[model samples]
Target: MSQETEPEPSPGPKQENGPTTTGSFLCLHTSPPLHIALHGMSALTHTRLSRTAFDLCLELLEAGVKPQALADIVVHILEFKEQFN
Candidate 1:
């Protein structure tokens, strides 16, 4: 069954690190979500994927849903986001 999620604490959409087309920024804030997601990506790829993946990872982390495995689910979610949209 589908469930509605609680709202996120992050800032609104207008505060993007870059333009929507560019999709992300170069500055590293050292947030937990970014720390994990940026683990293996190259500089170029990280800047590109960070926009979408960072938000998703932040949402998951805020929900108190820690995974016992490694970065597996994070990778899967990234792939899904890329594949579907």
Candidate 2:
């Protein structure tokens, strides 16, 4: 059986003059499991949970899991919760 691979995120245009303004910034793609996890947590009314989720994604990346896998994990979690709860 062949394992599916996630597509690489496109690197948007580089800014010649350095960082662009925050409002104009685009997050075209993110690592999967972690990204999905963070996005789900972001819906909560609690600020701490949201921040923690973001931090978790960063830590996962540091640990060397592919971003797409992290996103997929997040998606899996959310789906599991929906089915069970």
Candidate 3:
């Protein structure tokens, strides 16, 4: 997938696997294209999990994951989360 170069995120607490509710997820409040630009292919996956690909990508971008690397990271996050669940 195409990569977007971004910066690293500041250290903070990590998240856990959980179900998503409309009130719990992020970016859903924003315009669809903006959401798509940020989350890409992982949009639905993150939404279903009560997670936010946009939020994840922002954090990943801050962590130097780069925009282009987001899709891959989302894929990895999803796979990893699914592996144990």
Which is the leading candidate under TM-score?
Answer: 2
Which portions of model 3 show Cα errors greater than 4 Å? 1-53, 58-65
Candidate 3 total steric clashes: 13
Q: What lDDT, from 0 to 1, does candidate 1 have?
A: 0.53
**Stretches of model 2 off by over 4 angstroms after superposition:** 1-49
TM-score ranking, best first? 2, 3, 1
RMSD versus native structure for model 1: 17.0
| Whole-model lDDT per candidate | 0.53, 0.59, 0.55
Between candidates 1 and 2, the one scoring higher on lDDT is 2
In order, how many clashes per candidate? 0, 12, 13
Highest lDDT among the candidates is held by which one? Answer: 2
By TM-score, how accurate is candidate 3? 0.32
Better of 2 and 3 by lDDT: 2
Candidate 3 per-residue C-alpha lDDT over 1-85 given as tens digits, one digit per residue, 9 for 90 to 100: 9999888988888664343233323323335564556465556444444345456554455455555577676668878988999
Instruction: Please write out the lDDT profile of model 2 over residues 1-85, one tens digit for every residue.
Output: 9999999999999755432222333231334564566566666633333456666765666666677898788778767777997
